[model samples]
Target: MTTTSKLIHGYEVVIGFETHTQLATQSKIFSRAPTAFGAEPNTQACAVDLALPGTLPVMNREAVACAIKLGLALGSHIAPVSIFARKNYFYPDLPKGYQISQFEIPVVQGGEVEFFLGDEKKTVRLVRAHLEEDAGKSLHEDFIGQSGIDLNRAGTPLLEIVTEPDMRSSEEAVAYAKELHKIVTWIGICDGNMQEGSFRCDANVSVRKPGQPLGTRREIKNLNSFKFMQQAIDYEIRWQIEQIEDGHAIQQATVLFDPDTGETRAMRTKEDAADYRYFPDPDLPPLHISERWVQEERALMAELPRAMAARFVADYSLPEYDATTLTQSKAMAAYFEAVAKACSQPKLASNWIMGEVSRRLNMAEIGMEQVPVSAAQLAALIARIADGTISNNAAKQVFDALWNGESADVDAVIESKGLKQMNDTGALEKIVDEVIAANADNVAQFRAGKDKAFNALVGQIMKASKGKANPQQVNELLRARLAG
Candidate 1:
């Protein structure tokens, strides 16, 4: 639901997001080690990843390509030259004692992510997106009171996407994050598996009066799921409002959200740029990208969602809403196109896919690709409807049979279920005549201009024929007979 900015105890909620999208590179960003998930601990860590003595970091070209693709996708500016800096920090997982990341200069800058909250269109402005390496994981369980450090994730390529403080509510923040996830996964830049920590969100939340300067913010780190992201931001917003009401000054700090309790607790004081001691990495030279390279990459890129949606509207004459719904996923769009082409009925194909197909998919909690009905099978069923072999109501019965795998073929299902429409004009006319004679009150009322009476007469004809008659044909014949 789209929620407007409402004052909570005379304070407005302000939110910004920082998302880390793990690039789908086969290897680490600066090392030749494998970047596959679920590997045994420490197996993917190499000399460069472990930051051993005399080992130097090498930039992965594939990772750079993925970053470039994202910049182009988001309409961001790809810096001609970018530098990597050492982000000094200390932790059990930080084997190098400092992380190599972009400080002052990032590769992609000034992008916007657009999404819809219910029917409201919202756009979140992006500050910058930079390429960085993921740190190792700290295993706490099954260690007998001693935590073990797993360097497998260390040196993994990541694109840290930072957004401006544009979202006013947790709903808008979650919507923006979901749209970003769709884009990254749609463009093949990231796998976007939240459970595996491929895409992580950090929301910076604060509260203030309408005209007041931005309040002190607390950063909620590492929200992996959209559900948790919303819960965390909601709890943080309430907490800040309560703090201000109680005359407690909100402080800048890093916090972790406990999903089980639906609360955010301060983890530590938030560090600023000065605290990190950001400096240019001496071992790695400045990265450069030529205009020709950008163009070449653009040429090889897939058609984006927006452009594809526009084409669907123009070529297929679909409404903007239907086009957008169909293009939500590439597989769904392709399936719709195939059905439309095979049946030569774009509007009908769109309606069935958006209505019946979508309903089933949502109920089963599966994607369009997992649908049991094939495009050809759906087209064949649509063809039966268009050729007047079956009425729409009958077609639905046939569809159900096909979807449930009761019949392998559309024609076979229709034939076996005896769903063919009663197109015999003589037989349909006799049924309509019989209904007219039987329902004298309805016919008289319909002639007296009661529209419901006419509909009742049509329903009588359908029942008389055991629902085998074409509804349109019955209406036409019944109206003519009554007029005569």
Candidate 2:
């Protein structure tokens, strides 16, 4: 929830989220089918997945463990006993007439997702996160006026995380989605690959006038990219506002966003719980988990992102923002730690990594994993800057050489490019004296209590040193001369 005002056309936009995170299991939840991506259509699905006769559904223990892991990470209560139900539906992709999912009693009960909306902390309450098997995809392309069914994803295990209507604006919704993405990927339960359909989000968007009852909502399905997520939500908000303003009622339906058109179109009427006719599956017994098993899984859980970020703030004295950004991924956190430890300058390391390093990575359209420079190289560069061996500007040149594969050794790059800072005390003093004599007017202004004039004199000295002078040393010596 956000206290900040986010009203569009005198209407407050209400949003909820439903995210499907594909578990990193080797096999399907109730079958022996392989869960790998990019397999040939219908090749990976087995008899049990296809609902063939003489096949009985058997639950996978690993999937249950994954559910337990998510419950612990979100601070949710893991149900000691849960049931699987057959949700009756019909589609070309579903081999069976019904899909298996959790309806009445979900595994993970109630939790909250906390994230920062700019500088404000916001939390979205979770309704439930339940284990379900995904329906196969209906492929429209590569066909002549006919659709194709791909059952490879039919039986994949998924954790459906539902959120309350806590987001007030599209920005908050996007922020919440990204934070959830980082958590799932950090905990090793999901790959967070949007392109590969590993993680997907459905946004339930509605708009209502302040103090009015909740508006009818439309769900935008399969928003695979964060950029598109924001755009889709924003568009839907505007559309709903316009419809209400025109004296028309908003209809509840399922919609799809056309990225090319940048608008949402109605697909079909949305279905309620009664329409699905859910009933407990007869073949499978009640899914039960003992307290001992929950403890065992909790003991083996990895450190969550929020906890790690808090640790960085406490141990290294970093700002909360820096810690969060550095821990976006495990590899990124490891790289930052190595650089900070090697140079013994946590703030400097944070600045460089977040600024220049991130700029280069974004411009190249790659992640930290594909970054060309090694941690050791960056550490040595920062160490030189700390020791006054090179000016900050000179260090950039050295970094460029290292990043461009011109040289591997930091010292070699410094020497070859003549980037070493001028450390000769006597020579610097003489340069200070010459600049003072030539700038009598500026000197008079400085004596008259003008700080800008003093800065001008320091700039002259740095220019005379060919941008190689240590700025702090120059400032100190100039201050001493003026006082004398």
Candidate 3:
């Protein structure tokens, strides 16, 4: 490996993550407004969310319970009393000059979330995880030359999980974020839909000489995509190393990602916690959850993603790779189980899902939930292969047609297209004879033990069949004929 590829200078790369998980509540945190996505601009806003005069913030009990469940799951201390504070900021989308967030007395503290760095499970320490209300969004469009504001997502309940600066590499940080996202989604608290802005993350990055005081840190803001998060960290690490190499000091500032340019641009100087002017909100009362409420929330917790992934491995007798891929999404796991029950070999189902289904989704730039193919349909196709009704090559054709954006029946389409394999030995014999009679020179070369000449005969038979001949069957018959 090149020095640049392996060396991060004499300094070590350090990362701390702040992940925001949007609660799966039907309404906004502080209002009765519906919390739906892709709605008309500013339509979901209620008086409290819009900051109308005399309006008060009403806390959602469901949101509070969800946060408590996460806290317990992380093995953190759930403070019987946690206060809300105002984080002062200015933006068109933020109707209130300040956002309601947790500062001093957050709900949970000093917990850990464990994820695999490779084969080993490494736990990342958490500083805190707190409940907060999200701010609105500001959209800048190229066509209109005017910025638009969308309040549909504003005031949504958010659980911000902050971690200590324990991650040593970008790879570790990305892994930790992915694991945390799964836990939140699995618990049914947050949906963990990154593209929809339901689950997002920010990284606090810094570099320092071996055992030196921590270098100045920069905040990379609001990255929702995992791949983008990894790339952003990598670029920032390179940028920091280069700056130090050139005697330029690393500035403490907030940065924004330019996805188009594959770079992060300066947003503003990174603010200290003191800069937020954090103070408890007098308008709202402290949250006091009794022991009875805690137990009820505990009962609501479901099987965590890691445990569930392990169970799938043992119960289904699936390979670690297959289990990992299937459990990447909750929806994918459910789909896998349905097919696994229908088919005896869970591994077979896993292979088809990871191979064809995943390939089509990636090619079409869609999600598994949006895929046109279904578990039952895929199982039915697998049955056809086992029953010898279709060859493996023929089955691939049917899978392709099913994903081709048509309501095409798999068997009917295969029949209509004449995609069935030409397994008829009598017809194949006549074509093979005609090819050998026509190519006398090639036949002489084949008899003399030239394998390449023998291949030409198989290609001829396929061409005669318009590429529909069963290749294995053709090859077997031709070898028997050519030997005699």
Candidate 4:
């Protein structure tokens, strides 16, 4: 928990998270049913998934491997032995009367997620991450007064990561969520596709007076987007505070956020451990993982984002912020590396990628994988800037041409657009001389120690040269002429 809590309405907001990350395995948790999305309902649920009579559960090895990978990534302890329990629950979409999940001895235990909330590092400690099988979807859009059950998602492999109530605000919670999302997607365990329900967050939110005991929390379910996650938490915090201020006792319940209404409504009373009636599953034995298996999985893992960012800082001499921004995704980091290596200019490459490339990507609402400009093209453009073939402004023109598919060759774009800088010293000297002669008053101000006057003269020289004059050369020539 954050000690320096910024109270809202004289109450400290407390938040914890339960994230359901669907593992990227080819099959379900206990069956061989295909785990691909977009299949027709009831077609993918096998006998084992449907809990048919005499069909015993068989654990998927790949799912356990994925769990181990997550444990390693989060610095969690991977238990050599863990138990699967039957959680008794009644839902229309749950074909099995109970969900197979971990109750007491979860596979992963005692880790923490670290993230930057606007330059202040925040850490959210993990209570546990357990393996579980997902329930099916209850579809209600197409039917009137009747709902459809899609068992295709039943028995899907999932890792439910539970966090301590550490976050004190919506922004901190969102940052933590984003960092966790990046880690999971970076390691290839989960796709981190919240839109398709592959990644989901349930936030438990409450508010209490400073130094008071923790308030009763209401769990907001299945937040699919980061935007909605922050919004829901903010609203819930305000609601809880309002209830307390109005002398109403806050109830502990599960709630759902209505994005359309921007308010959360109670779904049902939250269930405790006893309410679920959890018991060890008799059909499946205890899960046993060997130390050798953990080592093998760790060896197969790629360098994580944090380590990659640190390397960028050390190897490329980049600022911490630049390194962090560049490594937002694997594709982005790979793109930066390719451009930097080709041009042998890491700082210049970092500037362009974090500045122009990021701007275009945001405007197009696309990821780095969908960027139109290739690494070679960007490298060529950066090389031109570094070699004084063009100015920064001219390089932007070349970048625009490449991004919009107007031209593929950077040199061709520069030649056609007449973006090459005026490198002739004699010609630049002549332009600078003429500008000084034309602007006598500005010259006198510069001699009088006014710096803006010198800038005005430089601007006039560039204008007289049609913006092709090399700025460095212009500055040097102007200083020499004024001195003489």
Give the top-scoring candidate (TM-score): 2
Tens digits of per-residue lDDT for model 4, 338-392: 9999999999999999899999999999999999999999999999998999999
- Give the 10-residue window scoring lowest on summed lDDT in candidate 2: 1-10
| Candidates, ranked, TM-score | 2, 4, 1, 3
- How good is model 1 by TM-score? 0.92
User: What would the per-residue lDDT of candidate 2 be over residues 1-484, giving only the tens digit for each residue?
Assistant: 4446589978998999999999999999999899999988899999988888998889989989988888888899999999999999999888888999999999999888877776677888999999999989898975578788888998899999999988889999999999999888888889999999889999999998888988999999999999999999999999999998999999999999999999999999999999999999998788898999999998998888788889989989999888888888888898999999998988899999999999989998999998888999999999999999999999999988988999999999999999999999998999999999999999999999999999999999999998888899999999999999
TM-score of 4: 0.95
Provide TM-scores for the models: 0.92, 0.96, 0.75, 0.95
Quote the positional error of residue 268 for candidate 4 in Å. Answer: 1.1
Error of 3 at 414 (Å): 7.3
Model 3 stretches with alpha carbons more than 4 Å out: 1-11, 37-55, 72-77, 88-97, 110-123, 136-154, 168-172, 182-186, 191-196, 210-213, 298-302, 384-391, 404-484
Which 10-residue span in candidate 3 carries the lowest summed lDDT?
1-10
Tens digit of lDDT per residue, candidate 1, span 1-484? 2337867778888888999999999999999999999999999999999999999999999999998999998999999999999999999999999999998999998988877777677778889999999999998977587789999999999999999998998888998898899899999989999999999999999999998999999999999999999999999999988888889999999999999899999999999999999999999999998889899999999998778888999999998778877887889999999999999999999999999999999999999989999999999999999999998899889888888989879988888888899999999998988888899999999889999999999888999999999888998898899989
Candidate 4 runs further than 4 Å off: 1-4, 141-143
Per-model CA lDDT versus the true structure: 0.92, 0.91, 0.84, 0.93
Residue 144 of model 2, lDDT score: 78
Minimum summed lDDT over a 10-residue window in model 4 is located at: 1-10
lDDT of 1 at 35: 95
Q: What tens-digit string does per-residue lDDT give for candidate 3 at 1-484?
A: 0011123767788789999999999998888999888898889988898898899998999999888889887888888899999998887888988899999999888788876655555778899999899988888997988888887778999999999888888888898898898788878888888999998899999998877888898889999898899889988888888889999999999998777877888899888888888888888899887878899888877766666778889999987767876887778888888888886668778888888888988998988898787887787777766655566777888887777745457678668767777778899888888888888888899999898998988888889977777777788888888888
In lDDT terms, which candidate is top?
4
